[model samples]
Target: MTFPTPSSLVFRQLFESESSTFTYLIADRTHPNEAVLIDPVDSTVERDAKLIKELGLGLKFGLNTHCHADHITGTNLLRAKFPSMKSAISENAGSKADVLLKDNQTIEVGQFVLECRATPGHTDGCMSFLLKDQQQNPLAVFTGDALLIRGCGRTDFQQGSAASLYNSVHTRLFSLPDNVSVYPAHDYRGFTSSTIGEEKVHNPRLSKSADEFKTIMDNLNLPKPKLIDVAVPANINCGVH
Candidate 1:
């Protein structure tokens, strides 16, 4: 479903099928060509770069929500392609990045600003980016793996904690306005996006009591990610080869 956006906002959600990852490109159309890319995948950096160039956008930052274990991030490659662009990640993630973001830290892309919210539990350093309009009304949130459409990131690895994830979502994310759009990093199912109100009611896992949520997470029995070993190490260094 399409979320209503301001006419001056340039937004694109690109997907990488192998990992089922969603990469977002956000920019201000009224500004002088500045843009930022969130949760970029290594395999799709070329495509992202081509699109940025074609759109005449000067990439300002390649940001990750956390250190991903399923796939390498495109931040390193993006920096290589666009020398002026910087790589950013949460400071708690213990990863190498040009900018180590803190909770509540704001990153500007021309006239637009993205506020980083510390939403760990999926990982020690997981973050969600909140984009607001000029008047400070919530527009959309890039939830990364912390929260998903009708689901959430598994709390089985990467310093995962069910209690922490539960708290993060309830306090940091659920508090947003009901109309704020939710954009997650990955989607195994066909869903693309959901709103805070929709997930609060329809999300099977997060909508349950905290104790129930933790119990469910502990028993998920999901298999290990295929690329954990390689992806984790590469991602720790900001996806450098």
Candidate 2:
């Protein structure tokens, strides 16, 4: 099916200050009331819902790119407000997902399709969502902590493996067209977006050999996320806590 028009797409980038997480909202402007949200935070549920309502958009889906450890998800709360809204995550994430997405699965929105590509590394079930045009042209990729502007998610916990992450970024993401925009789940530097070409040549971590990448990931003894204890459990249950 062909999309209404490029201008008929409603895309919003929302952020949560505490976790520096980016939540995206995509809807067809032709049907202004139907929308999908990605990587929503528990604390921002009311804020997100208010914006959706203010825009006269009805929530259709609450999707998590993966199980998060830094902050809780708002999928349950969103479903409470919009009973018809479904929650989804990667099938291997081992969480409660109304929809357990498989690799390469396509999520049908109004007139667009979100292609799910498993990019496990930051976590065993990390997935990226590729938003494509009706003609199947590449638009952008919502790379959950898997690939960032110039950095990436920590590969020291939650079944993280630097080798897996390197392979995912190289084969799954870098293979895309150079112009494809990359929208990561978090960015502490406040920068917004990047492209596949830029990341391939400039991403300090992934630009190097796989062996070096693994070495870097192994040596970085980063501290655990402040909310890991609370957030992980809450996120495991869809942020009901």
Q: Local distance difference test, per candidate?
A: 0.92, 0.90
Model 1: residue 229 alpha-carbon error in angstroms: 0.3
Clashes of each: 0, 1
Judging by lDDT against the true structure, name the best candidate: 1
lDDT tens digits, residue span 156-223, model 1: 99999999999999999999988999999999888999999999999999999999999999999999
The top-ranked prediction according to TM-score is 1
Global lDDT for candidate 1?
A: 0.92
lDDT of 2 by residue, 1-241 (tens): 1223377788889999999999999998776656999999989999999999998899888999999999999999999999999999999898887889999999876787899999999999999999987778888889999999999999999999999999999999999998888989999998888999999999999999999999999999999999999988888788878
Clashing pairs in 1: none
lDDT for residue 29 in candidate 2, whole number 0-100: 71
> After superposing candidate 2, which stretches have Cα over 4 Å from the reference?
1-5
User: What is candidate 2's local distance difference test score?
Assistant: 0.90
